[model samples]
Target: MPSEGEPHILAEIAERHARIGREQLALLRAIGRLDPEAPWVREGARDLPHLLAMRLGVSEWKARRWVAAARRLPELPGVAEALASGALSLDKVVELTRFATPRDEAGLIRWARHVSVWAIRRRGDLLERAPVREDRRAQRDRRAEWWFLQEERRFGLLAHLPAAEGAALAAAIERWAERVPAVPDEDGELPDLAARRADALVAMAQASLAAEDRADRPTVVVHTRLEPSGGPTPGAELERGPVLHPETARRLSCDARVQVVLEDGHGNALRVSPVRRFPPEWMLRQLRYRDRGCVFPGCGTTAFTVAHHLRHWSRGGPTELDNLALLCSFHHRLVHEDGWRLRRDGDVFAWLRPDGRPYRPGPPPPAPAGPPRPAPADRPRPALAAAAQARCAPGPAP
Candidate 1:
């Protein structure tokens, strides 16, 4: 057994190790924010974490986090130096980094040595909640208006709207929110009127844009049902509508049309059609359901994704359900035009490297909670099971 002195020495060493670890992390974070063109700085930033993780054989995520924390060091040079000299704890440096402004960050570090972490957090929150002056607020509003006009110039009318119209729309939305009943204090949760108004405004804008586009375009509704037939049963329900883009309408007119219907809560049809020619819509929907967002694993790019066919479309592969997958534009090109492979297995999808092994991806999110359980499993046993047993038994009282 170790003596008391031995245990004390071990504790001291462990504390020292933790202190060193924190300083190293702060340093790496500082480097990450540095200009990449600065060669010496770049070399240190790049090489340090790689070396640390390589030596420890830790996961890349942990290494990156450590480096990110380190990169904030330049914002708090005194804290960084103290950390390097083993004069301050790592926790203090982390608290200081939250204030990115150099002066504020330095002030935070100096204050941290004398105050509790809770006090620091409270002060930070208070600073964040401080109100802006009227002049500053007006300046900000003007700047936002100017930026909105600039966006209009860059992207044209589709992406831009006049400031007055936008403000009127916003006010109308707020009026709509004011009509919703406020929750009582007992309810413990109340609707955020501001957020509700914003959401309503966004939804209205999207619907308005979609309606406008549909009015100017030709649309053909195609009906689809799963039949006893081996493949999907597709039937056309054509109508004389506005003009559609030739390429888009042509895909619908094709013999190998992939028809699917998506509906709203009221059973009103949302989209009906011949799917995208490249990767069929059925496959894209399946990918969307399975992946929920971008299929790049850790990537959070949830914007529109392109359906990519693993096999080339020109090849013998039909644009059917099995041949399609959803990938963001970046990953789509990476798999098709560039050199990468994607494989699907049941509900799961995987990306593969050129070497033919699975390219490791992040784990899927946890499934949602299921419906409530019944009181007894056998209480409502199927009548069919009892009937079958009776038939198997010898003829009874007869």
Candidate 2:
């Protein structure tokens, strides 16, 4: 019960398949045993099959096979046929035989059809110029160091410890090593030398602290971005002091999108706005208490923190108190681009890991408990001493 049109369509498809097969076989045979590097071969065979197929609007794979077959032929009849049919060019077809194997030649031709001839030639040149035995030891060393740094990054507290402290610890270990006695048994066995050295240095530092008089510490710079909400109408004038840090001023000049509250000469609030767009100062104060610090899990960064809307502001998310969370640059990126999930319930915040597991944000484990305290001295001793003193001399209350 097939329609009459179906038979005609099937016949046309069969004829096309047959024509492509014949062309492929002819093209493959014609370009046999050509030098790959020769200008004619490079130009003609580089991507002839692919280019020819594209020109004919045929499949790249089909074009490759046709070019490969034409390359193997003693005469260029197949190549000529393809050129006549506008399937290939005489310049491109000549290089097809340069491939060591028919499979490689076919693949090259197919790729050529999809890609430009210039690209194929460039790739060939690059491949020819690539180093075979270059020294990679330095690269390997760098990779190892990179991996070590990545591991170190996971321990945030340790990562942030001053480099000077690390150097001092190393020096202490070296000094301790000089004082320790060497033993034949120690040759193959590792000792608890590092821990012993650390304990000795810690005790020495603590003793020094007890003897030295403490002095007033230097004031720390407060670098924070503020976002105020509510109160006065937008566009109120606020006085800001001169920029103390040139780098901070420069950064603000380039990308001053942080929200801040402006204060007048008398310390009265003026307005709130993104460092660029001025809003009322009272509004900025409203957001300060809600976002105490960066809301990102394990991030203590206060500077460069932004008030991010959990739901986008453009999508009808409110610019009010409840919808905003303070996030540093790194955490903001994680929430926006990286696949970290965040949820807030009442006052508590939860972070979900990449594997859909909840992250436990808690303090680090406490050090192991010390030995039990000694028993208290008996009260009878003090009482006996008091009695002796009373017997020696009766005294009135002072």
lDDT of 2 by residue, 62-169 (tens): 454444445454444433444334354323443333332433554565555566545544565456433433224223212101112365563111112233554676
Per-residue CA lDDT of model 1 for 264-343, tens digit only, reads 44445666645434444466567666555546544423354655555544345566656666565445545543446777
Of candidate 1, the 10-residue stretch with the lowest lDDT total is: 389-398
Please give the RMSD to the true structure for each candidate, in Å. Answer: 21.6, 32.2
The window of 10 residues in a row where model 2 has the poorest summed lDDT is: 139-148
Deviation in Å, model 2, residue 30 alpha carbon: 68
Give per-residue lDDT, candidate 1, residue 70: 60
lDDT of each: 0.48, 0.43
Best candidate, lDDT-wise?
1
TM-score of each: 0.40, 0.25
Q: Candidate 2: give its CA RMSD in angstroms.
A: 32.2
TM-score of 2: 0.25
